[model samples]
Target: MTKTVQLLQEQFRHLRMTEVANELPVLLRNAEKMSWTYQEILQEILTYELKRREEKNVEKRLKWARFPYYKTLNEFNIEEQAALSTRQLNQLRELNWLDQQYNIILLGPPGAGKTFLAIGLGIDAIQRGYKVVFSTMGELVQLLKTEEYIQKSKVQLKRLREADLVIIDDLMYMAMDQREANLFFYLINHLYEQSSIIITSNKGPEQWVELMGDQGITTAILDRLLHRVEVIQLNENDSWRLKHRSTIFN
Candidate 1:
């Protein structure tokens, strides 16, 4: 029996069914105990291999996403955000707009759940088999600046360009010179119409010119980004972080 099992495992591995090879013993045992038919045994083996492949694919995509943290849409507190309603949030989760390559701009003060919402949507997208990438504006700029000289930057930017949804956090948080603004514009141009974007920022598009420091570049960037976009303004009330801060004494 052991020799037979080993031979079967070796054959499965040679056929590139590594997952099935590893689980062959357990599956064989279950099949024997349950008296599964030949057809049932074949179905079980194919299903198990496909399921394991999907699980591994999801894991690979999540790692490629490089999210600061994993937070699902269900974890979001809709009650805390007056700007967005439950129905609207559900609509976003449906991802119809994402499928149409529409952009989403999340505007609000610090800790207004802009980043949290963006991250949540990104995670949801990943689960749905969409390629997603997360990068702060600062990190994106750095990546753009060094992409030519740094192999790591090149790889990261390649992933960004291939992503279905790109989330840029804290956009226009600092002023950028001509070169930086130009680099940023080229990236947006490449992604324009080909992919959707979710931008989280304290300042709106109207205020982006001030930080970009170049009217022409800012206008060009806005032209592509606002072409098919939804702007959601979050609440201006007390910071969500402050309201939910953990007390040391407690």
Candidate 2:
């Protein structure tokens, strides 16, 4: 029986069924003790392996998303934000908007949970089997400004194109020069209808005109983005960071 098990392990490795190969022996013993039939044992083993594979895929997708930190809708305390509508929050959670390539723009004061919501939705999208990428406005511009400008930009842009969702956090946090504005326009243009974007900004659309400093570029970027967008304004009374600041001491 030992030799037979060893041979089966070698065959399982060749078949790339590592999870089953490792866990089957213990499960088989449990099955015997439980008086499980052959078909029942086989079903349980397959179910276990399939579940592990699904979890592994979710982990891989989350890693590729490049989220600075992890957050979830459960972590968001909706009760505190009286201004936000429960219906709208539920709609966003449904993820149907992403299927239609609609953009989600979150405008609010600093630390009002815009970034948290964006990251949470991104993590949700990954779990639902959609590819996602997260980048800050400054990081994206720096990527475009690298030494191998053309080649590097191409590779980075391709990454965005391949994703089902692209999250741009802190969209108007820093001043944007003409070059940065132009680069941003180009990126937005490519992703226009091809993929969904989630933008978290401290400034609203009206404020972006002065933020970009170029009307043409600003208009162009907004035109494509706002065409099929859901504008969410998070108007909580106080910053979540400030409210939760004392929790660490507790």
Candidate 3:
């Protein structure tokens, strides 16, 4: 409420230090109460601003990612999913593969944790300051087809192109026509070596050609995806969703 405090806040706003500006009053009160030195106060303000900015950046990236749901690696039942060990999960979290632009292919049947795992990795990547985008195979195809004409689609595709990692869920869930197959291939080609990819699919690579309906297109797609990729097959006998489904009577 003091004139000096108001002036300081205005200066911070002018410098685009909005986070510090808003918290300046509280910070000053804490400093006074603690009898903090000038250096300590300055360090605290800078740390707070940096932390808030990182959090906001994560939020923005998460919005752009467009995950169907939020899930963390911690929530994944490692015991239930026998394929990926805790050590493997920890390694994945290190994100060295992502930094090296390596791709990940998660294969499993319906209700398996493939999608969940992909989303968890994507979330972790975002928190670590990487841009990520998530779209189902069907949604990606539609977006690619419409990008030329639709403004929203263009925006979405732009984000996808600029992302450090892209997650495509339910790949080859259905057969694609010649045109659809071509579009998908082109997108994959564009992202090849430029960004890491995480793909979740119920079908294996051998089965992908059948769904694509074009051996040549499938071959080209596979070439880029398999060039530097880690394939993990989730072979859990029971579906995680089915096991956790709530019953009305219960």
Candidate 4:
């Protein structure tokens, strides 16, 4: 109702406050300020809103949902994902595969969270705007083998040539027959030196050569993959998806 109070409110509406002490208390009357403590009101009304707006502009640089759990990277014990030493955590965090010039492999057995870790990397790359293709070994081989062998299949090969990262999960389950082996070699050769691969397999790198056979092709694939690679071996025992017999029987 006071003319001075009304004028003060109207004039200050256009001026955004840099500091609260100077601008705030004057704008809100002493009676209105009585509802709560001054510091609580000031932080909520001013600082919180401003910080939220600033974060919106840089949201893309932030990590994805899976990335938060990575803060707890562990190499031993699996209440959730075991406890990873700082050195191991740093390697996974750097995600050299995202660099596109270096490949990486997560070597482990069934239920060792190998696939989980591989997926985490794929999500991290996706958050950074890199395209990632994720597929199980059998599925990928079967899909690629579907079409009769033809030179034209190189169209699909072009896709691999352009991918930034290719995640092949469950790769050690079956021996590769001639057709599947050839298909695998072609894709690996095409992606060689151009894209990075993130593979999760039950077998270690040494075991893969004999399984894939044809040393010439295997050697080429191995050279590119191992040339610049981070091999993460999870030594945890089979722990995931275990059910308590008591609960199950009951």
Candidate 5:
């Protein structure tokens, strides 16, 4: 490499512009061949580096989100779930609801795509530069319980509060003790009106009363959640997992 090029690479590295450092040589050659103006060449380089950095940031946020699987709205079968309005779903992709701190409750039977929709929306939020965290109800409760003793729970809770959206999947898949319930409620209380939440549950609000096993506390929890919420019920008859179960054995 030329001394000038090497120095430029070092400067780019110092600035953490790995993309520019790596692509500068090829881009320079192209600019030379195309007889581009100095201003045009500079704009091209800056645009490419900025796009690369944005993509990397999105990837990092998605990694931190911990989605169960990578799914997008394009992969979802909107036709199969006719109950969901196409226009509304498209609007959701715009992510304006996050600004409104609206909670989305997806209720349906098992394998009805509740989790899939939640993960898809979480991915969308990450792509739009919104911080997101995805965890199963049990997993989050376990984290809170384990960290509660060491006072790490408060630190962890503070971190979660920074997210624009928090996705809780498969809630009420298992019953919780009084302590667990309290921990869960604490999280809800903290995030309430401060951040948006997307939850997938096999049980509906009425059924949650029994699952929680404490009507009074459950009522308090539900009150905050439902105060500004969009309830989407996906009542497909067949389970997508079951339909695709043969793929694993095959």
Candidate 6:
């Protein structure tokens, strides 16, 4: 065992356990018996430390403060949902999109991976060091209902407009009433040119009017969102849900 390894392992031992100091000599012998070079051993320790720091950072980001929670991409956990083709994923990679100011609409039936894909994209953006806000339509409306503003409702509007990537999950789940529809329009208009938006909805563009129950508001929202966005229509698979394999965590 090298003197440096002995010293470092002893230090780690003292920090971990009192009797750990005695185990360091044996630990170093095993590490040496593996024929690891000094550089390789140092790199292994560094890698472990780096991974610890990364896990902490991921935890912080998952907290509600660093990234405000409307919903969680991690909660969606659609690791087996094969919605996109390899060609499309390659195109998305080549484009490096999600950074650009473009709207993305995922239109499909329930359990068709719309919300899963949208949350996946949001997770991707967060890992890539971009700010993101994810909220469902019902949750967003409830927020608006509770927040009372005397002058103008600018704070929420500003957050929506300034976010690097905003995700609105379950877009047309409930038909927005008069006031909610107006507020929704205000948000869509504000985010039109400034930032990117991703929306997951069961209703397609053609069925939006019926879902919203207002022709004017539906047209206004769709005109802005669809103008610069690409609509991905997910095919309805009858047995896809049953056949999908989900991993159970310990």
Task: Give the winner by lDDT.
Answer: 1
The alpha-carbon deviation from the true structure for residue 90 of candidate 3, after best TM-score superposition, in angstroms, is 0.9
What clash pairs does model 5 have?
none
Q: On TM-score, who's better, 4 or 6?
A: 6
Name every residue pair that clashes in candidate 2: none
- Taking all chains together, the TM-score of candidate 5 against the true structure is 0.92
The clash count of every prediction, one per candidate, is: 0, 0, 0, 5, 0, 0
Superposed by TM-score, candidate 2 places the C-alpha of residue 14 at a distance from the truth, in angstroms, of: 1.5
- Looking at candidate 2, the ten consecutive residues that score lowest on lDDT are 144-153
Best by TM-score: 3
Point out where model 4 deviates above 4 Å: 1-84, 147-160, 236-238, 243-250
C-alpha local distance difference test of each model: 0.95, 0.86, 0.94, 0.63, 0.85, 0.67
At residue 161, what lDDT does model 5 achieve? 77
| Per-residue C-alpha lDDT of model 5 across residues 143-215, encoded as one tens digit per residue | 8888846565565555577889999888877888888888778879999999999988988888887667789
Q: Model 1 clash pairs?
A: none
TM-score of 6: 0.64
Question: Candidate 2 residues 127-234, lDDT tens each?
Answer: 899999999988887876662657856666677779999999988878788987887888799999989999999888878988789998999999999999998888
Please identify model 6 stretches exceeding 4 Å from their true place: 1-58, 65-83, 93-95, 149-161, 245-250
Question: With candidate 3 superimposed using the best TM-score fit, by how many Å does residue 196's alpha carbon deviate from the native?
Answer: 0.8
Q: Model 3 over residues 133-209: C-alpha lDDT tens digits?
A: 99998899889889999999999999999999999999977789999899899899999999999999888898899
The 10-residue segment with the lowest total lDDT in model 6: 64-73
Angstrom error at residue 35, model 2: 2.4
Model 1 lDDT tens row, 119-236: 9999889889999999999999999999999999999999999999999999967789899999999999999999999999999999999989988999999999999999999998
Angstrom error of the Cα, residue 28, model 1: value is 1.2
